[model samples]
Target chain A: MRNIKLTIEYDGKRYLGWQRLGDSEKTIQGKIESVIEQMTNEKIEIIGSGRTDAGAHAKGQAANFKTNSEMARNEMLAFFNRYLPGDIVVKKVEEMPERFHARYNVKGKQYSYYVWNDPIPTAFERYHSFYFPQTLDMDKMTAACEKLIGKHDFAGFSALKKTKKSTTRTIDDISIEREGSMLHFTFVGDGFLHKMVRILMGTILEIGAGKLELIVIDEIFETKVRENAGETVPAHGLFLDEVYY
Target chain B: MRNIKLTIEYDGKRYLGWQRLGDSEKTIQGKIESVIEQMTNEKIEIIGSGRTDAGAHAKGQAANFKTNSEMARNEMLAFFNRYLPGDIVVKKVEEMPERFHARYNVKGKQYSYYVWNDPIPTAFERYHSFYFPQTLDMDKMTAACEKLIGKHDFAGFSALKKTKKSTTRTIDDISIEREGSMLHFTFVGDGFLHKMVRILMGTILEIGAGKLELIVIDEIFETKVRENAGETVPAHGLFLDEVYY
Candidate 1:
């Protein structure tokens, strides 16, 4: 058996996310798993590095599945591209070691959020980006980012009410960039909890818009309560950028 | 009375070009005109700079209409952006001179074409760009562009069956640039016949792919026949970038 790793890119506008839910065809994982089952003639399960939410896009999502078929890497890649929808593309296929796993072996991940900080929304990018119709103070947002760049319990920033697992995670960097009327937020971290990035975006944008004070970051960190954080920004603006092994 | 000059941008994926046909509401012009009429309580015709084909996007499509309503420019702009569909946006609304017209007073136009020069199509931009699997020779395409520049009768490169008006047009420049797996084609010209840019793109890409020789451009110019030229690329990749007055 060979452990095949896949790097996938998808526009997740219509997908229910990267996990199969019963037998719904609107999920990214369901669609790919069904295609793989058809190709291999066996029940197969694909392990994603992270399960992104519905409507969130991915540029380099990593996944892995074990197979016994003796097909070339390029052929399997082409087969997936041919069978999958146009919005979901398997960018690369690699035969990994037997012990290689998609989720358990993950080292780090990168995520990006797009915000259109203009009075009006853009026509083409409205679906892919969040339209924040308020002027953002970059300095205020940058100050807020500084408060979150370290190992901390981000439980307050997650949408999950409670989890038994450890909520502490290491965030190596958080960069904020402005290009014209678009604000790009990049998050590099070891792992993120459910809705962590969206809530973080909401908290930072609220700070920049003067709705919340910079000290709210400290309050959230200390409280570790979901209600203490800002609202979760829409899923469409979020992107699973990359997964590193 | 006010003569309003509006700059518009739209994702033409669901639009039937920019012209109204009968009572169909699928056209961009029809949608905007109805919205304007709803706001002003009067029927008004929108004159677009060019009648783009179905699925052709526009970044800066110039249009104008005469109105007797006493609404301010900003108010009208906001109203249009509010009422029109999310895919269509009125970027700017200006009260122009009495004699200003969208079509007749145009000085020059700029168009852009996007080609994904790779084997697999991009998931995000599949609708906005053309996927070409063939490897393109940038030097050959650039040389073909040079042969077609300046004053020339581009009648052979049009999709129109026949036109009584002269097909002579001035092409100021055509630049081809490659960035990674994407090719960007920019065309600047005083005027263009119907489907001229699409045809020009197809011809040049064919030349770059070694399917057509460099002399084919000169032969098409002399022959003045639509059949003498290469195929017309799809309408989705074409973009009306700007209309300069």
Candidate 2:
């Protein structure tokens, strides 16, 4: 048995998300598994590092699967590229250690959300970025970013009311950059809860727009209540940029 | 009556090019015209700098329309943005001279074609770029670009068989740039014939792939036949980058 690791890039616009749900083949994982099943002629389960929400794109998503096929890495890569849809590409494939697990062995992740701040919508980025026509205060948003950094209880930011897993996660860094009318938010963290990034973006954008006070960040962190946070931004603007092992 | 010039930007993925076709609301010009007609309650024909082929995007496409409505520029800009589809945007709107015509009072144009040279597909730029999974010889392609410069009868490059209009047009400049796995070909010229940019891309790409020699450019020029040139590339990779007046 050989364990194969795959680096994937996908445009998540048409996908139901990364995870395979039931028999529905509208998912990113289902698409890849179907292609692999056709190539290997075997039923095999593929494990993803984590689930990206529906309509959320990924640049370097990691996955691994155990297969008994004798195909070489280059051959499998070629096969996947040839068979997989153009929107979902297997960027790299390699033989991994027998015990390697994509989900359990994930060390960290990086996510970036794009915001188009101009009054006029960006034609090309309409699907990929959040279009906020209102003016934003960059200075206030930058100041708020400092507060979001470091380890904190992100329960208020998640979509779920409660999770069996601990909600306390370390946000290594959060950087907000502005280039012309485009604002980019980059978040590096050990792990993220469901819709945590989107919620945080919503809250941060509200603060930038002066709708919410900057002190709301502290209130949300201490209370650990979902209602205390701002609205959950759309999944289209979020991208699972990188997954580190 | 006030003449309004609009600096337009569009994704073109969902558009049937920039021209307003008969009863087709899918075109970029048709969408904008509909919005204007709704706002002003009058049927106004919006003239574009030129027609981009179907599936061809634009960053700075210029258009002009005559309207009797005394709407301010800012108000008109907001109204168009609100009513237009998300994939199409009016970046800027300004009052123009009554005689200023988008198609007639022309100067030059800058068009760009994006090529994803790597085997792996781009996650974000899927619809905006062409995935050409072949090793390109930049040196050979550059040498060919030099030959393609200056005033030439580009009848061989166009898809149209016969036209009364002169086929001679001066190419101001052609520059090929590579950034990572993406190759951008920017062309500045007086005007392009039907599918001229795409045909040139196909021919140049063939030269880069070593399938066609650099001397084929000269032979195609002398023959003045479309059959002598390479295939016409896909329209999705082409962009009307800028329209200069």
- Residue-level lDDT of model 1, residues A164-203, one tens digit each, is 9999999999998889888899999999999999999999
- List DockQ for all candidates: 0.83, 0.81
Off by over 4 Å in 2: none
Worst 10 residues of 1 chain A by lDDT: A223-232
* Per-residue lDDT of model 2, residues A64-170, tens digit only: 99999999898998899888888888889988899999999999999999999987788888788998988889888888888998899888888876668888899
Reference-based lDDT, each prediction: 0.92, 0.90
Please provide, for model 1 over B88-111, each residue's C-alpha lDDT reduced to its tens digit, 9 standing for 90 to 100.
999999989999999999999999
Clash number for each model: 0, 0
Chain B, candidate 1: TM-score: 0.98
Q: Estimate, for each residue in B105-188, the C-alpha lDDT of model 2 and write its tens digit.
A: 888999999999986767667788888989999999888888888999999999877889999999999999999999999999
Relative to the unseen true structure, what is the C-alpha lDDT of residue B97 in candidate 2, on a scale of 0 to 100? Answer: 88
